[model samples]
Target: MTEKIAVLGAGSWGSMLAAILNENGHEVQLWTRSAAQADELNQKHTNRAYIQNYTFPENLRASTDLETVLTGATEILFIVPAQATRAVATEVDRILAKLGQRPALIHGSKGLETTTHLRVSQILAETISPEHRTSISVISGPSHAEGVVKHDPTLVTVASDDFDAAQRFQHLFMNDYFRVYTNADVIGVEFGGALKNIIALASGALAGLGYGDNARAALMTRGVAEISRLGVSFGANPLTFAGLSGMGDVIVTATSTNSRNYRAGYQLGQGVPLADVVANMGMVIEGIATSQSAYELAQTTGISMPITEAIHAVLEQEETVETAIHHLMTREGQAENG
Candidate 1:
């Protein structure tokens, strides 16, 4: 069956996913906020600013009209930034209400709401009317827009509290080049996706400071451990941390140059100011905000997340990158399993 899918963001990741879906023979509507971008994609079949060197499928439509994008869509995927999820969901709710239609909701974004510290799915649930929401799922893992655009082998996880919904999402995106797995651990999957960015930033900073593979390896290893600890405290399954959305995500984001968080951290390590790093990146660095939220969540939950604390300190300018590294190294040693 050819499903009509609406993608609610035209950023790199969103546009790339829309292209992939179009390739899979699905009818795709990619919504962008800018009329210029919509016109460009419609006329040129290329989102040059976001996904370079790639032409979108001719059948893939781009629009700035939210109503036109959502009209007759079987599924709606929210690919906007985490901070924008609530606002987008509210708008979606109004549209769904006016249309008297309900569609499966999926989110590709990975981060918590800064003040509420709520997961993306949670925010969606709060804003979208229950009657108008079929199911909520999140797609996250090691997949990057740059690699996915090139059709490189990519694997990701789709998680939902409803197992059937997870399987449905897994089926939707799975293909020869893109593999999807189903997981019922929504909390773990979301946290693993969001928190890994913090570690990526830290790893990038370490590399920028001339640290080698050993330091990066250590940071990644310890980073996943803390992620699992904090996630477990929040009712997430501890074993989920070992799966695609957990260790898998951490490895890719923390080590790959494709990661915005890693890039931001690298610049920070080179003594670039946070404001400058953000201004120059041209994309949202999710870890910068996530670090603060994660640190606050840890404090409230009584979980020990030293790596998150260190990254948060550096991002907040409370400590220099060098000082943060030194403090981490000088911390009292504890059992690896603890």
Candidate 2:
């Protein structure tokens, strides 16, 4: 029952999935671009740069060889940062074509490219042919790798336009500690997955300002509204926002102590420079890129997303948190539902 699985990134999230899949009796191969890191994981059984405590599972292997990873991998999980996704996907496609085999693809990263403003699934569709489309799935939600790696109970949604691929992905991920659900709304899933990080940054800003639950609650609720609105504009089902990938993800990211975006924002709110905050966090904060993409998408679609705009402003340091709040609160009045 062991399946050949390849993870394309060896960051924290990638290493976590490699461990989880290995625990599930899968042949897991974790690929990192850094040969030094790969050698360390192969010899030390640990990813010293990311997850420090646990040794990699015995069945899990690490390598810098992309061809070796793709040739034998029947299912490949793409876990690189969102900005790097396209390059990695293109490389993977070329490697797979060279091998004359197409494997199922799963992306665990969240965020759209700021320059292209394309969702991960859309980028994948463009990179791979329709014949390979059925093999793509997106697995995302509130599940943080830090929690999941420790065997905490976490739930996430795996979505594909293709139903059978969703089911197959569900089987690959579901376990006693990890619960997997299936949905066909790939657009909404991807949007919610990316947008929540931006909102979490806003939530952290509010928390750092010593704002009460009222502020956090408002940010979370209205944040979901904006996310859902923008998602529906992209042809995603409006209902997916209420599911695991949307509201569920927002809650976890906005409130959790482990969220990198939230932590970055908290420091920003406490008067730290954005560059310093990111440097101190020592992780890729997807929200920083996602905020620009959301702002651009909102402008293109003529959709109103004040919260995302506020986050964008703060990110650019165009306006302080106080000014951003004042702008939001004193904006022209409209009906609550409008």
Candidate 3:
């Protein structure tokens, strides 16, 4: 069955997803905050700033009017930054309230709300009114927008508290080039998606500092261990950390040049200022804020996450990346599982 899908946000990921949905035979309305971006997409069928050298489908329309986009949509995908999810949800809630429409909510953003340490889905539930809050789902994995735009073979997980909703999204997104899996472990899936970014930042920093393959391997392995420990504290299945959103995401984001967090960490490892790295990238480095939230969560839960703590110190405190690495290496030796 064909569906009208409203994709909120016009960043690289959002635009790529909108294009994919259009290719899947869905009517996709991509809503952006910038009228100029909307005009560019409509007029040129391209978003050169975000996804250069690529063109969107002619049927994939772009709009700045929220009400117009939401009016007849059957599903809404929120792909904005984590910090902005609440505000956008609030706006969607208000518009839905007036329009008397309820659409399935899907969020593709990966990060915890720094202030409340809530997952994007949790923030969505809180901001959107109960009546307008339909089934909520998250689509996450090692999939990167750059690769997805190029139609590279990709696998991802769609998790939800609602099983049917997860299946719906899985069916909607799965295709020859993209594979989707459904999992009911929302907590684990979201944690795996958000926490892996922190590890990727560390891995990128190690590479930036001229570390060899062994060091990167150690970081990736121990990084997932700590991530699993912290995730278990939050009632997430430890096995989920071993799956696509977990191990798969960590490997790709940590190693790929397409990851903004990795690039940011690379610059940081090279002794570049954080502000300069962010300004030059012109994209959100989610791991920076996620590291802070994970560090705080670990402290509150009494879980020992030394890697997260080290990354947080390097990012938030004036601690040098070299010193942070030294501190981690000098920590007391323990069992591999301990």
Candidate 4:
């Protein structure tokens, strides 16, 4: 069945999803605040700012008007950065008030709100009332926009507290090239997607510092321990971390150059200033922000997250990468499974 879908945010991920939906023969309206971007997508069938020189499917529509985009839409997908989720969700709530319909909500963004440290799904839950939406779901994994747009074999998980909602999204995005898996562990899936970015930052920094794959392998292994430790503390299923949103995402983000967090960390390792690294990236380096939030969270939870703390120190405390690495190396030894 062809469904009317409203996709918020016109960044790489948003455009990628819209194009896929269009290819799936769904009616998709890709929404952005910039009128210029909307016109470009509608007229040129491209979003050069995010994905350069690549053309989008002609059937995909773009709009600056939230009302027009949300009107009669069955699904509203948010692909905005985590920090921007609340504001965008608030706007969506206002528009939905007029339409008097609660569409199934889905978000593909990964990361936590700065001070609140709330996940993207949490922000949506706070902003959009249960009465104003059918259910909320999060889609996350190792898939990157650049890879998915080219029809590369990609898999991701669709998670929700509601099983039916999860299956609905699973069916929505499933295709030959893109596989969707259903998961009921929303907490595990969301946190896995968010925390792995910090690990990728550390991985990139290690690579930039001329460390070999051995060091990265060690970091990734330890990073999984940290992620699982913190995740289980939050009532997440342990096995969920072994799945796509966890180990699967960490592998790609930490190893691939296409990962913004990895690239940003590499620049940091090369002694590029954090400000310079972000400015050069021309994209939101989510791990930079998530590091701080995760550090704060780990502290409050009284969980051990040395890797997370190392990345946080480098990003926020002006600690040199060398000093952070030294601190991490000198930490008291413990059992690997501890």
Query: TM-score, each model?
Result: 0.98, 0.96, 0.98, 0.98
User: Per-residue lDDT of 1-338 in model 1, one digit per residue for the tens?
Assistant: 88999999999899988988888888999998999999889899988887778888888889989999999988999999999999888988999999998999999998989999999999999999889988999999998889987889999989998888888777778899999988889999999999999999999999889899999999999999999998998889999899899999999999999898999899999999999999999989999889889999999989999999999888778999999999999999899997
Residue-pair clashes per candidate: 0, 0, 0, 0
Show where candidate 3 strays beyond 4 Å.
Answer: none
Clash pairs of candidate 4? none
The segments of candidate 4 whose C-alpha lies over 4 angstroms from its true place after superposition are: none
Candidate 3 C-alpha RMSD relative to the actual structure: 0.9
lDDT of each: 0.91, 0.88, 0.91, 0.92
What CA RMSD would you report for each candidate? 0.9, 1.4, 0.9, 1.0
- Tens-place lDDT per residue, model 4, 158-226, is 999999999998888989999999999999999999999999999999989999988999999899889
User: How does model 4 score by TM-score?
Assistant: 0.98
Tell me how far the alpha carbon of residue 28 in candidate 1 is from the true structure, in angstroms, after superposition.
0.7
Colliding residue pairs in candidate 1:
none
